[model samples]
Target: MMLHPELLRAARTARRPLGLATVLLAAITLTHLAQAVLLAVVLSRIAHGDTAALAPLLLAVLAVVLIRAALGRAQRLTAVTAGATVRIRLRDTLLARLGGLGPTAITGARAGAVRATLVDGVEGVDAYVSRYLPQALITAAVPPLLLVAVALIEPYAALALGLALVLALFGPRWWDRLLARRGKEHWDSYEALAADYLEALQGMATLRAAGAVGRVRERLEKRSAALHRATVAKLRVSLVDTGLTDLAVQGGTAAAVLVACSSAATGRTAATGTYLLLMLASECFRPIRDLSREWHAGYLGVSAADGIAALRTAEPAVADRGTVDARWDTAPEIRFLNVHFTHPGADRPALDGVTFTAPAGRTTAIVGPSGAGKSTLLSLLLRQRDPYRGRVTVAGTATAAYSLASLRRGIAVVSQETYLFHATIAENLRIARPAATDGQLRAAARSA
Candidate 1:
């Protein structure tokens, strides 16, 4: 199965740890082979009624086992560390990009759906990095090495095992694209459910007042059912893929075992050789089985990776805001000079070569009919969005030169729609000026 391209790039961020884990996994596979060889020797010695070589063989087996255990522990630690590092870095990048998109772009988004993608979606990819990546490398490298060892003793057994290995790795290609499509559907369904559930929660009071809570509940249930169906469809493809892999593994082992038994019965291969052949054949398919199992385990994560990749590719609401001056403490004359601004995907300019000036120290009002871009004009003044063409200057200084934070500090707007913070009434009122006295707040409220 193919990993998402963005995920591969994210994985590169933790390359040092993943590389170390790969080496450790390779060592573990080698240790397992050594232990198997020791077992084969011990068994052959027992068949010959020789106990003299038993102690050394057993000691070697113990040593291999201990080494394998140590490698296993180290590999796990590395995997966890690498996975965490990748997740943290990717989440940070995702958040930063979202922030760069500005408030207008993000405000309409479903908070709960975005939260799910940011939290659960990021968490989901841990297995892909921790288990699937290291294991995949071992799966590719170890099987061939084992095949060679088997070939040295019994060529026919080796050939049979090699064919099965090829099929196990290649047979899933035809269905993999379809599985990816299903996986994507599952992820989208989950996001829809989260969005609907969160929207219902936030609008609970409104729903109750309107007596539409039951309707919303039914809609959420439908979304939940859709998610379940998508999950089941994806799982069906995964199970079938896993089953095919198991079939190849079992078939290859049986073929190898049959050849070994026939050679032993005809006296063409010694008991030690037959024993080694059986043990090595088992080793050969171990990686394939692991690859299949981990692929299934990490498949859902691939869907998450796709979501993150898609989000990263989206164009921001505005072009990069270049730079700005320090804080703005006092208002100044605001001028829009032949400004021509067009939003992304708009067919006409919102500003359309507009020229206007609001003199400082005076009350100025902009009146226009609905959809005449009055809000667009305010957005330009605040630098929440920038114009594609024209100059917006405050007190003869280009507004673009002033940092957005500094520019916004000196200007205030009572938006057409009020948005109260989820805090006490006093706290919400105090948001405009944290230092306002109780008397001052009461006076301002009365004035408004």
Candidate 2:
């Protein structure tokens, strides 16, 4: 009931599997109710000194138990599949979004923070998808179902059980506001610690060279301590909520059982009906208890709601579509006309009223000191970003008119710093042209 909307959206992508899992859970619950009735009947008959029904009733109970076990396993498998499907879909979406955003997406934050959002954040939704969400659906259906079954035997007992169910289900909402606040705090601390730790690892050499490793270590310890405190605070709220739920379950079950006992004492129902009502009453709160445990288990997903939402809602830097052809045999002149651009959160534009032309068949060298808009100008040509004002044209056509693939394929850049993948030189070279022949590879290497 307290599910995050973003997490619910992610689950919707795998609704088929989740729906199947829910059906399996419902089947499993029915089996439990069946076993309860059979055992109750068996116990009532045994008390009446009837041994004839023992063997067949016990066998029926065993059979129901076996069927329940099978259904439980199937439900677990379906739920797990749903969770994995959602994770994969979300990761694919995030990766594609990041790709469209290009390198500029990481400019505002450390690479580690992006990675944490992409990886750990998506992983956090698994429990909610696989366990808690499905269990919540079952909880909604099961308690009312048990109430109806008990109503058929004794309406007074059903009334008592239904009231208890309401108390158990709604009692935790009082603490929900507190838990949600603590959960957000915990996630913030966790993300900060993870980001800082990873950034420290990546910059360890620089820290050591500057003799600041000790300072970095101390800072990380402080962050770690903060994270620990946040975690304990969240856990404290969860423990209290859990205690309240347990108290409701116990109190609710006792109230229902007492009503059934009174019904039997008043001769409104026989021993068999009393036993059946008691057995059914015992199970009325089972789904609620399961849901309580699942909420605890899936708390990580709740905490990570913001991170997941951020990734899903990120906008691409530029559209990937274009209509103009970019298959010319010869290089075209590149021109920037009164261009303007700004980095997010910056005081001023990186480029303002910039105009330049690099004629075809001529080499153009753009040289500037650090923090200049030189790199920004080139990024516009690659469509890594669109100009805020004016146009970048190639061969008299605006660069935005050409598809990213064709435009990028027509240009080659030798960056100041080279990055090689963890592969052989040939493999890394082939990344740019996967079908390059051996002679073509040699030519490219020689050209480099």
Candidate 3:
């Protein structure tokens, strides 16, 4: 049930709310212990036929139960709030990072895989943040407290329960590697399937043209089957771990029960003491049980951690963070001086020692066959990428000197391929200049 470091780091962002939630869980655990003791006393009294003393004790038990219920509800609410805060903040950070990376960094990855990281991957951490993390604190704290209570009553019983707790906690470590490997495999399969489906959707027309739609569908079926197999393998490992945990829990409880019965039979402790030992022994394993359940529910967060880390660490194409003004007095001459660039992981440079100049206020057309570096030159001007060697300058000032926002604000681009949002024609046109008036939009439309 070890949490990934990335998940723990993200939890720090909502420490206050999560702290409150953990406190609530600890309070709830104390209530359960109190309830167990109260029930033991009530049962003992009933055995002694002390009907007259039952009223207040039963009322006290009722009050404790009600308090525990209220605390449980508050803990849930606080945990959910913390999860939401972390998810929103993390998503915002990832979005900013992706924006800085630009197309040059992301274009090499599958579109659906990127979308999964931004949406589903972010959501996957919610259970771990909200439930598992807070409960982990309870699991660590409550069992020791319970053991001390039992030890005060029956030292031998406490020792037996302690050994069981050790086994339950550490025995599962034996298979943790297998579980983690399966979890990663499952996430990889999911990403691959998502990417494949998205690619198929985007290229449906091309598939139909080539009469390969059926073949693509068959491939998607295979991908879906692979995902299913991975999921089953992960679940199989989880179920086995759960079985081992349960065996430890039940075996420890049984051992404690045997010790408690022996102490009572030999007249070492009274009925109340025996009852207390029994209840505390069962209660000792409660936190571990909750931890096991939460581990199953929130394991996806562990699997998604790598994806989140990858996006958070990816380097942006324009790392200079330009500061000089991109707004020139006039359309300044743009010069590419002995520029060289190569795409990531490519064997050869896209532009090798290329040099050119476009005069101010002059229309320049760069002609090239497919795969030539014409578009690469445009990309450099737009700061989508920097040149590997030499510099791209406007009026002798390097483009890297201007802030990204200011530089982009001063440039307007019309791409070779046009894309329109799901909006009216005017709305689509207004995307580039949101404040454009109807007359301006009409003029732009007419000119186009």
Candidate 4:
């Protein structure tokens, strides 16, 4: 299966652990082969009626079994660890990118859908990183090792197992492609359903008041149906893929078994060789079988990956980093010279050819009935946006010339709406001055 570039990029963050896990998987495969060999020898000894040597071989088998189990457990745990780490890093990057874009940029789209994608969508990628990815690496490494093991015991069986692997791994190229396509379609429908449902739920009251609830419900039902169909289609692909893998495994194993049994019956092979052939042949396809099953999990992850990648590539809003201090920090004069600006999707410039000056150390009031660009002037001075024509100057220097932080530090606004941090009272006030003391906080409160 093709992994999304974003997922591959994220894997680098947990590369060390995933690599260790993959290597561990190879070790587990070796241990499994060892266990099979030990058991085969013990069985051969019993077949020859050599019960006296059974005790030592039995103990050896037990030790190998225990070690294999432990390695399997460690491999699983490491895969989980690698998955979690990569997921956290990717989610954090997405968050930082979204934050950098600021409210103005995000406000252009559906907030509900964005929220769903940020949370549930990101959460969905863990299966790929933790399960499918490591297994894929293990599959590549394990099969060859298994092939060698079987060849040493019986060459014909190795041939059969190798042929089976070829069919299992590469025979379903078209099916895998279809699976990925179906997976993407499913996720798209699911995300749209979530976004629409959340938005509709939030505005249910308004819809009810306007007597449009029925229409909204109808649209939501249609979206739900689409999602159902998408899921069914994806599931169909998964079932067919699994069936094919099972068929290959059984057919391959049976052929290997027949060759081994015939050689033994004809005295060309020993009992131990026949036993090893059966055991190792079955084990050979185990990893490939696992890869087939994990394919669905990986495909689910691909769905969320697209949204995460989009957020990551969204051009970071122009850096707001303040490099130089504002020209004036206190009671600075504001001048807008032949300035022009237009809001998004607007028919005409809101402040075309606007010219105005507010003198320092004096209060100036902008009065307009409605939509007269009253707030626009304050926004320009705040450096929230830049003028399209001419310049907005503070204390005789263009506002853009100063760093965003330094320029904003020189201005303050009292808005009708208040935005507060989710923190303790003391911590919230600390935003105004990070080093403010308890006494300063009390005094500032009283003064306010």
From the highest lDDT down, the ranking of the candidates is 3, 2, 1, 4
Candidates' lDDT values, in order?
0.84, 0.87, 0.89, 0.81
Tens-place lDDT per residue, model 1, 73-155, is 99989988998998899889889888667777666567787877788888777778777888888987888888998998989
Best model number under lDDT: 3
Residue-wise lDDT of candidate 3 within 58-162, one digit each (tens)?
A: 999999999999999999999999999989988988899888888887887788988887788878788888899888988988899889989999999999999
lDDT of 3 at 283: 95
In terms of TM-score, the best-performing candidate is 3
Give the total clashing residue pairs for model 3.
Answer: 5
lDDT of 4 by residue, 1-448 (tens): 4567887888889989989888888788778778888888888889999889899989998898899999989998998898889879888988888866755566565776677667776666777777788788878877788899788877888888888888887777658678778878887888788888888887888998999999988999999999999999988987887777788889999999898998899887888888878888878888888887777666766777877788788864345754667745478888999999887779988899989899999988889877889887887777666777879888988887788767776676667766677888889777867999999999877876
Per-candidate clashes come to 5, 0, 5, 0
TM-score-superior candidate, 1 or 2: 2
What candidate 3 gets wrong by more than 4 Å, as runs, is 421-448
True-vs-predicted CA distance for residue 46, candidate 2, Å: 0.9
Global Cα lDDT for candidate 3: 0.89
Off by over 4 Å in 4: 317-322, 326-331, 361-363, 367-385, 405-448
Which candidate, 1 or 3, has the higher lDDT? 3
| Weakest lDDT window of 10 consecutive positions for candidate 4 | 315-324
| Better-scoring candidate (TM-score), 1 or 3 | 3
**Stretches > 4 Å off in candidate 2:** 319-321, 421-427, 430-442
